[model samples]
Target: MKVSVWDTYVSREDGKQMHFDILVPSDLKDENTIFNFGKSYLKSKPFATKGLTSKECRFCHVEQASESIEEAIRSKGYYIIEMENCN
Candidate 1:
């Protein structure tokens, strides 16, 4: 199994910043499980839940992010079967 981490920054109304760290497991099959876990983790954090919603497993533009995530995984000794955004 491989794991990928994503860091997303969203702006808040008070000029502060909110960050969401999303962890995606390569072998994860159930989207609902991932979403639920992410939601629970973010909700338990100290920050107010006003900015970006909880970290999401499905990204609209995941190509570039997936490439970066895959590289990071490879560095950690995971065997990558396929990768995108090589450039």
Candidate 2:
């Protein structure tokens, strides 16, 4: 997968802005697998698994991951939204 940093944008809820990186995978199948793996991994985290006590950014990351999956499906392409919440 090839990753590229894109422009950043401020979220609606807060004044804080974040940089976004887009990951473009050569193969669509790989992208699908990666997305699923990411979701499973994040959802398995203690914070996410516990309840609503998780940080807001954690929830945002999950939403972003879901968006990436949809983008891949709609365009028949691969992409990821890398934010500070991501390692």
Candidate 3:
């Protein structure tokens, strides 16, 4: 599936930066919904994260999704690819 990749850099409560990608269908353009998806991902993490806003997350690119990512988006409406300081 074609996906929109949102490059996100959020400040962790521990004073470190967290980088990740918020992936959703390219057609999904609602910023609020995307931010909510990002919030949901943060909730799944053990550490607390600063609020996710447009300043912290922006459209990075669009690309073809992998099989796993496609399946994830099919079920959850969005998927996250954690890049740094996730643990």
Candidate 4:
């Protein structure tokens, strides 16, 4: 499946950065939905900052989804690929 990748960076309360990619189907063009997905992901993190907006997250590109990513998107409407400082 093809997915749109939204590159995201959020600041942690401890003054670090969290970098991740939010992947949704390529046809999904709603920024609000994408940002909400990001917000949901933040809620799962201990370092979650209270802000997830267009400034922190932007549409990066569209690419083929890996099997795991496709499965995740199929189940939850989106998938997340953590890039940095996510632990």
| Ranking of all candidate structures by their TM-score, best first | 3, 4, 1, 2
- Write the residue-wise lDDT of candidate 2 on 7-48 in tens digits: 233232233333343334333334334444344434543332
Order the candidate numbers by lDDT, best to worst: 3, 4, 1, 2
Which of the numbered candidates is closest to the native, going by highest TM-score?
3
- Candidate 1 lDDT by residue in tens digits, 1-87: 345444445444455655454555645446565555555554555555443434423432222236666665456422222122111
Clashing pairs in 3: none
TM-score of each: 0.40, 0.26, 0.96, 0.96
Worst 10 residues of 3 by lDDT: 42-51
Comparing candidate 2 with candidate 3, which one achieves the higher lDDT? Answer: 3
In angstroms, give how far residue 16 of model 4 lies from its true place. 0.2
Q: Score each candidate by Cα lDDT.
A: 0.45, 0.37, 0.94, 0.93
**Highest lDDT, which number?**
3
Residue 47 displacement (Å), model 3: 1.4
Q: Tens-digit lDDT track for model 3 on 1-84?
A: 899999999999999999999999999999999999999999998888888999999999999999999999999999999899
In candidate 1, stretches whose alpha carbon ends up further than 4 angstroms from where it belongs are 6-17, 51-87
Which segments of candidate 4 are over 4 A away from where they belong?
Answer: none
Q: What is the Cα-based lDDT of residue 46 in candidate 3?
A: 87
Model 2 TM-score on a 0 to 1 scale: 0.26
